[model samples]
Target: SLGLEKMPFFTDSTMAKVMLLLINTWLGAPYFMVLISGALTNIDGAMYEAAEIDGASRWQQFKEITLPILLLQTSPVLILTFAFNFNNFSAVYLLTGGGPINSEYRYAGSTDILITWVYKLTKEQSQYNIASVISIILFIFIASISSWNFIKSKSFKEDSE
Candidate 1:
């Protein structure tokens, strides 16, 4: 069925590309969830057994052993997931076109992310310079957040070890 909400905000080619990215991300998360579940299964059962022997409750066992191990195994998966969600475009575009409209904002629809907005401006509006500027800003934001996550993961490893 062709719901109005299902339409992309811009029929213009520029916005179409952003919509595709959103779609890809929504599809990608299930794969990540599979990997995460597999990682959880790989955690050693022996540790839990030992914790139980020591009178640690199930919650304590999970908190002390399961979570740490899970975190260690899933850190990279988490990084990938974060990156995916950060740039996720398809889910947004397929559903809303990123707008029902907000004119007060310089270049945004209700659903526009920095990345999608840039795509629209460059492709639809022919505003290459502004698109590039927005792209740079997004790159910086993603890089900084990823770097922080990596650092924190490293610290977590150190403390746990």
Candidate 2:
């Protein structure tokens, strides 16, 4: 609610996109924070003590020791977060409902992600066949990404070895 009455109209797709991202991040941060805090607790204190003995500065300790352990331990959660965001429909649907339509794109609004677009096609337009096709495509895309993430996860690799 900036003084829009005083300022010139600045309607842009980028502003809506940025706002959506910020809102989604705000909604998602708490979950990731919990995961990261658990991972942090599990990190070995001996590692930090060794780093301190080696005259490492606080930044150096964080960079060389803390960051790597957190990343390695939480990589799976990161992948899960990516997957969740990829298919996230409720946030976009509830907040914007795929609004501020772009005239150029057929049946698609500027803020519509793939899932919301599919929902619109099915519910509003009665395009069941097209919606089904789009649903299959979305499923394939998510599955591929999830499989790739599992393959790349440290736990999966460790189990294989």
Candidate 3:
């Protein structure tokens, strides 16, 4: 009845990915916003006042005071969000059903990310070993990225200090 399936938004190979991206962004933006807003609240009002007294413009205040602090506070969360979203299965599976199948790739759809591909590989094709390998590789890849980001983030350094 929703007619989502028949819609070109979900049926075209390219458009389906745009729909998936929009859906994923719509789902995730709130959580990131909450964290970021919390970080903004935590920033010392004294800092802004000090900047204002020194004749720093709002743009200058943001560039010097707000942006760096927010980046420091939220970098870890951002990295982890990336890792989580990188493996997001429900976003693709529920929205697209991994449909608008790609003619080029075997057993894969245009909107299908690694995790959804694993689901299809294991559940439908019974390609257990291939799925397992992909899962392990994905784990390693995401872990490495998150670990690197955390190691480089000011939060991690400050926490260690």
Candidate 4:
């Protein structure tokens, strides 16, 4: 082993939250970057030209042409990512194990999101009934979000004429 000591990332409450945030961001950012860049490239150059001909300013062009297209193109992935990260067990579990315990919350740590807290309830605390109820509620909530996203998403709407 190298002489350099390993920093205790999980020892402090705020630091653990920061570390978890950093980890999740670092792990997930590149995929979104690649997808967004791909979406950017797919935008037609003629749209900007048309907007320019219509006397629209660059900001107007972006607002009118770019933002809507990008939002439509990436809305599905964005929604899915939100749902996935809502219960991202691995990111918090593998990195900090939901550590830096807080005295305020019983059976939960500072970085413990709801999913990890449920996990702790079931696995560590042996409180199966509460964990089951929580899991059911979480499933219903996530399902509702996903259903709403699909229903309201312009990208997913089928045109029937």
Highest lDDT against the true fold, candidate: 4
On TM-score, the candidate that comes out on top is 4
- Candidate 1 residue pairs that clash: 21-90, 22-89, 22-90, 22-91, 23-90, 98-111
Tens digit per residue, CA lDDT, model 4, 92-136? 888777888888987888888889999999999999998899899
Q: Residues 1-161, candidate 2: write the lDDT tens digits.
A: 77556321124566777778988889888988998899899988999899899999999999998887888888877888787887789887887777767898667788888889898998899988988998898889888988887787665455443
lDDT by residue (tens digit), candidate 1, 13-120: 456546656666668779878877897888778888888889999889879987877788778768867876667676665565566466766666756767668767
Each prediction's RMSD to truth: 5.7, 3.3, 3.0, 2.5
Q: Which stretches in model 4 have alpha-carbon errors above 4 Å?
A: 1-8, 159-161
Error of 1 at 79 (Å): 1.5
Q: Please report, in order, the local distance difference test score of every candidate based on alpha carbons.
A: 0.73, 0.81, 0.88, 0.90
| Candidate 4 local distance difference test against the native | 0.90
Among all windows of 10 consecutive residues in model 1, the one with the lowest summed lDDT is: 6-15
Residue-level lDDT of model 3, residues 16-87, one tens digit each, is: 888887888888789888998899999999999999999999999999999999999888778888898888
Q: What is the lDDT, from 0 to 100, of the residue 60 in candidate 4?
A: 99
The lDDT, on a scale of 0 to 1, for candidate 2 is 0.81
Candidate number with the higher TM-score (2 or 3): 3
Q: Per TM-score, what order, best first?
A: 4, 3, 2, 1
> Residue 1 in candidate 2 has what lDDT?
75
Q: Give model 1's clash tally.
A: 6
